[model samples]
Target: MQIQDLPYPDPGVPDVRSGPRFLWWLGRNQLGGQLTSLAWGLLHFMAVSAQPFCVGFAIEAVIDRSGARLALAGGLMALFGAATALGDTFLHRTAVTNWITAAARVQQLLARKASQLGSALSRRVAAGEVVAVSTGDVEKIGWFVEGVSRFSAAALTVVFVCVGLVVYQPALGIVVALGVPVVAFAALPLLPRATRRADVQREKAGRATELASDTVAGLRVLRGIGGEELFLDRYRRASQEVRQAAVSSARMWSLISAIQVLLPGLLLIAVVFYGVHLAREGRISVGELVTVYSSVMVLMYPLRHFEEIAMAYSFSRPSAKRAARVLSLERATDAAGSRAADLPSGDLYDPATGLLAPAARLTAVVCGDPDAAGRLAERLGGHPSEDGPSVLLGGVPLDELPLEGARTAVLVQDKDPVLLSGSLRDLLDVPASGEVGPTEALAAAQCADVLDALVQGSLDAGSPMDAHITERGRSLSGGQRQRLALARSLFTDPEVLVLDEPTSAVDSHTEARIAEGLREIRTGRTTILFTSSPLLLDRADRVVLVHDGVAVAVGVHRELLHTEPRYRAVVTRETEEETARGGVLKELHALGDAERLGDNERQEIEESA
Candidate 1:
């Protein structure tokens, strides 16, 4: 079976039985490569085992003192050496290829699962956990899978050598065979303890990795709040805990290694002692005794694989479990059998809160809780929800529409919009098409000065539209990134554009210009601006003050200010305080009258001309 044909575990499924099963899954996917690797490993081990027999033959040939026998022994040695060299080379090449392919397959599976989960992945699993599983865990899993073929060949070599020894001389052969098992099985008792220690070590290492990732991502915020040292100290403590776990794991493995050396040496001694007795009793000939001794010595080599396989499994099982957990995260589900319906060109309704936004009219929602506002925006944009009322665009249920279709019709630009790396022009180019152009979008977003500033810095020296942006637009200021995000959203020109605190980052003057530009650019399109800014609110055709998640009052901004005290208190807090201070209110009232007069004059001039 090819890798493509292998059954990838479904992310929604929870049970994953064993490490060998996972390895078998990997092998089935790359059957041809695995077979080639296994064949090479068997040939390599066979070649290695042939060396001892050749040495034994040479020793016996010299004792015989025959020219033909010596020549035959020399010929066998040469053949064995050449074969061993060739087999070793091919074995290494195949083994490394197996390792790389296995790693790549796991990586491909992980990347595909991540994409399938989309935004829901981060919600289900921590970002640091995902990173750990992909990088460190995948490599360990590959290591275990590649070790399987090599270890199997080693065991086969040991078995074949023991049989050859017994066939030549039974008494000596029995001693050698029994000694081999003793050397290999001596390490079994300590393996369970070693494995447990290794598991603890790996878990601690994953935690340290997670803590470091979180620290780096939030470094700026931590420093801003004067908590850098606190987090640093916590990370240092985590690092120490990982160090302790590593030391404990090392101690267990070190004990295993000591036993691996000592038990094998004792077994070789017992075999040689027993073989000497057999020769004294004349039960085995001198040539047979030499072969028995040589085979016993060589059998020690394959016995080492017992320890290696134990260690590989000790590391791999926990790693596979970690990877499996990551792969098992379920993606968010949409309602079954819900189909997209035609949206009405009238009021949008939310059945849960019993709210409606009249056709082509500006509507404001004033929610007491900030989270409630965010949830409302998500519902308005047709994100899947279980508890809330279905949001209806026109009279059509928003959730019933296909994702792409709903997204095109209504866009909810969140408060903290992500700014991808790019120059001012590239940043403003949403959908990044050269057709809509950046000039108009930037002006509408009140980002003309931002573009000019970038141009002045030689940042826009090349084709402005093609200029590179850094990741997350980290190079730009917070307010600049915000406005650029706004510009990109405006470029999309969707039917119902929902802005959540769109003007929060900009100054009052720029905010006012953005409000005026929005009214002009989105003339007939339904737009909802979620903000308590008086400048933006006064420009709205209607305002809905949402208190306790319900739309309580709806009217023009000025009308709501007079009729609803809660609405007036919410929007006019600063103005009311200014009025108490005497001159500030007079200045604001004069500015408001000036803006009204300017609008009247512009209207009159347009009418006359």
Candidate 2:
């Protein structure tokens, strides 16, 4: 495909059977591009090789004292020069195009897989490994992909030159041809050692990346617990291990590079020594000797591609394997049951937890165990569990619906929903029913303060909606990020919106406002909030108190608080939860407010809280 046609309409289904198979599949898919590049490579290398022959002919013409033949030889040399320049330019263009398109295809496949797996991706793969695969591994795979066609052309050029030499002069030609194979395959024995070292380096690098990512994600927590040095030391050790592995890998590759250089140089020396002897004995003409020597020199150019091909394959093989492993991951819901023909429109019933969230109403579930609450949210969104049957909606199993269907029917926003880096408008621009606007969703999620912070923090002083958010929304406070995530979820306007502790980070006043806004915005739609805060529970149309993964009481917030002791205990404990936010959180919240407030005002807000 043309470069303009890239990012492809489809990357096509990949062969995840093995790494080598997947690499082969990528090459097969881009056969047209590869052929185009190969054609250019052939033209370029042929022109280059023909120049040495032209030079030899020029020497012969001069030695014969023929002026006309010399001019013709000069003209042919210029013609080959022009062809070489033209072919080289186009060859580079096509090769780069192949590389970029190959990388884009892999990126698309990885992104599609990540979407399919959702939160489960983190469970199956290390965050660092995923990051490494998507970034470093992609480039390596693309490098091998783009190099393959060039390597083929180079190999063909070497063979063509070898044959030309054998026909032109047999005595010296035979010697050169015999030496070519040895030079080409000289480093093959060391390749396994080099490849193994590269694999070790990649593995250690991935581990270091994962450790660094985890440490950064929990930096605040580590600092709070006075464990920052502990993690720092761990990360330091990981980084050192990565460095050591990289050094070891580099040594092996260096040895291979040395062998490649030394063997080719030795071949050149042997050719020169034998060619001089033949010329002195008058076995070949002066011009024929020049031609033979130049032919061997020109042959060295294509011979380098041999080592390059080996190196590219060594690095890309493991990278392709990692990408293949991730792509091979199947969503649990896919194998749970057969596809449901229609979207279910009714209560979400989890038989495992014995909980029912009626349709077209807001239901609040207060699960004592946070883990159980998360699992329930997962099941409600069609994530299968080996513990029990899949959740049902409208008497149809949720797992029976296709992944996209299930996602459309049920949207679950976990307690710590991630915020991808982008403009505020882009973050809210998700796949939705188009029933909710950004303004309304922001209002419903009580994100006015967040909007203000984003605008105030903008260095460009441009549109507030265009303000850039840092990766993971680190620029915003925990509460602000939470509200922003909630706003994004609200904007989707799904059939069923499951929010787990959506307002946990915000203060009680903000939480109460959010609870009321959620009730108003989610009216006439199925909404389930897994929260213990009385503020959120009071706003629910019906409340279910879950104990030990089962619904033990069902009533309004006030009714259950008075009638059920377990419910009362959970609700009262919310006060202690509020108080626990006083120590380090007080400082964190104060620092967040300090971005938009004066010191005295921030201090007052913190004191009042």
- What C-alpha lDDT, on a 0 to 100 scale, does residue 281 get in candidate 2? 94
Please give, for residues 1-609, the per-residue lDDT of candidate 2 as tens digits: 777886788889999999899999999999999999999999989989888788889999999999999999999999989989998999999999999999999999999998887876776799999999999999999999999999999999988998888898898889888999998998898999999998988888899999999999877678779999999899999999989998998898888888888888888888788888989999988888888888888887888899898999999999999999999987666643477557879998988878999999999998878887887787787775755688888888877888888888999998888998889878977899899898999999998889889988887747768988888998788899899999999999999999989988899999989989999999999999999998899889999988997898899999987567677667777454345434434466557754767788756665666
Q: Give the TM-score of candidate 1.
A: 0.75
Query: How accurate locally, in lDDT, is each candidate?
Result: 0.73, 0.87
Every model's TM-score: 0.75, 0.84
> RMSD in angstroms, candidate 2?
10.4
Candidate 2 shows a clash count of 0
